[model samples]
Target: MTNVAKARESAVAAETRVEKTVLKVLDRLHALNARLVALHGEIKAAQPVSSGSVCLELYPCGPGCAGCPHPRWVKYTWTVETPQKPSVLLSINLDAKERDPVLTLARSTPHYEKTAELIREAKSILLERKKILASIRSLRNSARL
Candidate 1:
């Protein structure tokens, strides 16, 4: 084959390879977008009835303090945020109020944790999508197509 024909063949092969790569990148981008939508939906749907943090607090007393039998108690504080009301702090003492329903529900439910995990996953996926797009742009510029 002549030199000109050989160069044409090489260019056609490079173009074909670039086209294949672009298609694969597009497919990945579509999948990532679908996953992001699902994650956002689930995160939005999750509405915690009540959520709080529990901690054990020790009183300022000596080892032999006759004032109180127990110096340490579990303190439960909940922060509730909603469209109607935001940042409503609810305090519950498990040591004193053992029958508190909010603490009980919060202990048994993992809504907050799951929502946080979903959000993190969504963020990583978004970053990945952005990187993929940047790479695709570079590929196009390099290929001059």
Candidate 2:
């Protein structure tokens, strides 16, 4: 093969390699974005109290007057209402020192950190790919001359 032909082949091979590398980097970025989206869903689900708790409606009558016109013994009903505010409920039987499991899980998960690092790396890779592609285009133009 002629020297010029070999040089052209080598340049084309290099450009192909760069394109493949850029595509791989973009695929990795896409995977990272999916992971971030999943993590966001988990974070939202782990939030305290997705639904409300049960409430009691109490009716009090005259003290110690079981036979009074207003009977001391009263009947009450339980109802469920959505919590308008944030509050944590602890069972009477559980130890007060128990830690929150949801919080612990969220804090320990590496998804957030990994997502941030992936975003930075993806941005850098994209920028580098753009530059390399421009160079490849220039080479093709020159080859046409």
Candidate 3:
């Protein structure tokens, strides 16, 4: 019932709350790190080809072609190497809408790119979470003083 006793009780409660919050943050960071590892493995397994890089290029109709039906066209090029054979360059233009063998890659390529983007976003979030946890720890330290 004394003033000093009440202040001590309140401080203890606040410390407990901060500790719980820190535990929650640590749990989330652990989960995120696991997800990051799994995503990396999936991306590696989903490699489009043994060895190749996908490229996207955009070409404008032209400076004078103001009324061109197709102002711009998208092209995807894949350079792959086959066993016991020279490297082959495969190219496809989206404007034509013609189906090509490489069209199959279109699906997987986007999935791969999207997963990569997700990984980047997750990494950024992980860094932010770490910063928040650090700040919380600093706050707790200052409170102890």
For candidate 3, lDDT tens digit of each residue in 42-100? 54454454333322222346675322212112233445557888766555554367432
lDDT of 2: 0.41
Best by lDDT: 1
lDDT of each residue in 73-141, candidate 1, tens digit only: 233455666788777666566657644222343435557566556555665775687788678668667
- Positional deviation of 67 in candidate 2, in angstroms? 75
Q: Can you write out model 2's per-residue Cα lDDT over 1-145, one digit (the tens) per residue?
A: 9999999999999999988986885575455444544444443343333222111111345685221121011111233445775444432211133432222223344454443343334335434545554664676679874
TM-score of each: 0.52, 0.36, 0.46
lDDT of each: 0.57, 0.41, 0.51
Give the distance in Å from residue 16's predicted Cα in candidate 3 to where it truly belongs. Answer: 0.4
Ten contiguous residues with the weakest lDDT in model 1: 65-74
Which segments of candidate 1 are over 4 A away from where they belong?
Answer: 49-109, 136-145
